[model samples]
Target: MSKRSESFLRSRELAVAFKASIPVMMGYSVLGFSFGLLAVSQGLTWQWPVLMSLLIYAGALQFLAVGMLRAKAGLFDLFVAAIFVNIRQAFYGLSLLRPFRKTGSLKPYLIFALTDETYALMTTRKIDPRLKRRWVLFYLAALNQSYWVGGTVAGVLFGSTVHFDTRGIDFALTALFVVLAMEQYKAKRKLLPFLLGAGASLIAMVSVPADRMLITAIVLALLGMFALRKRIEDV
Candidate 1:
């Protein structure tokens, strides 16, 4: 690449970051808004969503945690459930370790903020330099977090009057997983995880209770991960 082109890319990384962040910003806001509405409806205080957004920051996981808490689950139960539900994120981060090595001071934030959407965007995006990559990563995190915080604030303010259908809100998590799975398939052309998840779900649906479902899925997912590690590395 030419020196001028490289310089321009570095300078314009913010624009790339913003453009890449738009889709995630939209999805997270709506989903986060829905969670906020549900939280308030379940008698949670306004700060609940804020704390969730700040502390957990995993969009789908936080929403699931809220649901479990609303159901009167204990802290230990919630923690264990979260371990199973979010173990996928550990794989997501592992997949990005090489791509994220050059993020410098922003590496921690990039790792922490790597939701499925952000991971998809980062993996697909083509940038020239390490600086540009970090810029993109930082912007994705900032924008997504903004959406979550903003949506939660809006929900807290207007949840009482916004009598909309929430039946479809749960699909946000499902949709994200589908998108991530598709991304993985696109990258590796693998069907193992998809089949594994389906098989596990079928077994869990028949044999596992509601609370145990995630646990079973986690075990199955880990086994699948180890089984496919060689395929993944080869790919």
Candidate 2:
């Protein structure tokens, strides 16, 4: 294909992909709204989620990072802590290289949107070049950001009036993780990493406090992946 033809095709593909991701977009909005509400209750302002949606994009990482802030954690401490929670993204990126290599400028957005949910949707594809790869990434980035932004706005408005307990809300995140894990398990080979990760995370949760469990889980998952890299490739 000519360069111009490829560009046009990519754009069209992205548009179609965006349209197809409507359900996930709606889910993002609802989840983001819940996150925003939680943020406000923790004494944060709208700018926080706005900035977080634009920059961090990783929902679980941001959620964990905010707790450090709430505790007045030192900058260095926050960095050290977040590094553990977010190290999984590096693995996601490794698996995503083929899809993201064609994305050019959209590569950063694709990387940013590599949340558990987004990864679940994109990686299930058995074939590729299905959409202009760049466009596929753009659609994912835009859809996720829209959800996060919409949720933040809703949370800011509703936080004051709602009085229900939020303890159950934490489970929303857990459920998302479970769904993502289940999706990753379609392949038997993939099950090894998923189980490895789950086992590591469970061990960490047992040994660490809620605030630091993310770091522990990340460390253990990374070590587990490294040790089992050969087996992980068999799938």
Best by TM-score: 1
TM-score, every prediction: 0.71, 0.68
Clashing pairs in 1: none
Q: What RMSD value applies to candidate 1?
A: 5.5
Name the Cα RMSD for model 2: 5.1
lDDT of 2 at 98: 88
lDDT, residue 48, model 1? 80
Return the lDDT, model 2, position 20.
63
Best lDDT goes to which candidate? 1
Model 1 stretches astray by more than 4 angstroms: 1-11, 128-131, 160-213, 216-235
- What's every prediction's RMSD, in angstroms? 5.5, 5.1
lDDT of 2 at 134: 63
